[model samples]
Target: MTYISRAAKILSSRVSADVVILGPTVIGEGTIVEPMVVIGHPVRAKLMKALGSDLGIDEYMDSISSGSQIGSNCIIRSGTVIYEDVVLGDNVETGHNVLIREGTRIGSGTRVGSGVIIDGETIIGSNVSIQSMVYIPRGTVIEDGVFLGPNVVITNDKYPPSRRLDGVRIRRGAVIGANSTLIAGIEIGENAVVAAGSVVTKDVPPNKVVMGVPARPVYDVDVFIRKRAEYEGSKAP
Candidate 1:
């Protein structure tokens, strides 16, 4: 049998309570602060400490790393490490132990899954669904409504042993499967679907589906659009 830990239970004890001290911290009022979680933000933490006697903030830097920006109405589940200069929009939800690096702009309603590593200077659009353990390298721009499967690796260097080149751009609504690796400088078109474990090395056309290593077309529109339309019409209400 597994035992679950409650956040409220840890904060109840004076000796057991782990205090955090920060500058410019701006957490919302009536927010539940769990025990043993150290957060740093100088001015805001000091302001909140003066107001509430229930608050205890004196060891933030000793426990958690600094310079992370957490927005309002966000649910950062336990064990998450948000890196510096990462701008998370409102209503973003992150699972445990997620890593969002510096200069990353994740749009509103984006759900960064557990254990995912989003590298620096990347732009993730609104409503994007990234699964666990995905590695989005530097300078990649993932457009809105994209679905990334678990363990997908998006590389930025077209040439191996590269000298800090820019990353690839995945257009809107593209679905990349688990364990897939996308090569740099290629533009994946909108609404395209790449199958699991594929290696992307070229440009993918819009509204198409590809599979296998070096990802070739398997489900082009010419092969199934007419049949699909007939099926849709037959089932119309």
Candidate 2:
């Protein structure tokens, strides 16, 4: 059961909506956004009204863009700015002050916490958990079962603030901890674990444990050999 407050009802007349509204937001049609939520459009910049009344063409345009794709049974909380051409699957939850940029595709059952800036053209797979203050750079791919801890920053530029080209790919089951940095063009193998506060400059092996600046292998040769042998033995007679 969805409930719309009296305030939301009055605000809905000045705005667009589907079922419920708990706070201020310039929403689109067919969207059932939840309470205390602020969806679409970024509170109109100071320089915007100085130029024109065409809020549609203003810097905060996504606050009122059409053709947005929000699936059923999703909970979009307060102060979330979902940009134009963004597509979200069912059962997705977005917390406060999160900026989901245009051309992004989010799979089902993904829970994104507050203050996350998911850049354009990023593909996030199902069952992913992204904590707060994480910046998923443009054109990146986050596959299934991936977990990103708070303050995790993923970059796509070896040159930073810009890349020679566009796009970076993060494979499946890759768990990046808080304050870790991933360099450009490096493929983090499936099920890899990156330690907190580490800086990665090279490719990480599958199911491996890596840490520290220019993150290297933490396990000894004997440990690697023993683990590999045990794995191999389990598969054999």
Every model's TM-score: 0.70, 0.70
Q: Tens digit of lDDT per residue, candidate 2, span 170-235?
A: 678877879888777777778777888888888888777789998997853345557758898895
Q: Look at candidate 1 and tell me the lDDT of residue 128.
A: 95
- Among all windows of 10 consecutive residues in model 1, the one with the lowest summed lDDT is 1-10
Per-residue lDDT for 226 in model 2?
77
Candidate 2: segments with Cα more than 4 A from true spot: 1-32, 35-66, 161-163, 220-237
lDDT of 1 by residue, 111-148 (tens): 98888987677999989999999999888999999989
Lowest-scoring 10 consecutive residues by lDDT in candidate 2? 7-16
Q: Kindly report which residue stretches of model 1 are placed more than 4 angstroms away from their true locations once superposed.
A: 1-66, 221-237
What are the lDDT scores of the predictions, listed in order? Answer: 0.67, 0.68
Q: Which pairs clash (backbone N, Cα, C closer than 3 Å) in model 2? A: 40-63, 41-63
Residue 36, candidate 1: C-alpha displacement in angstroms: 6.7
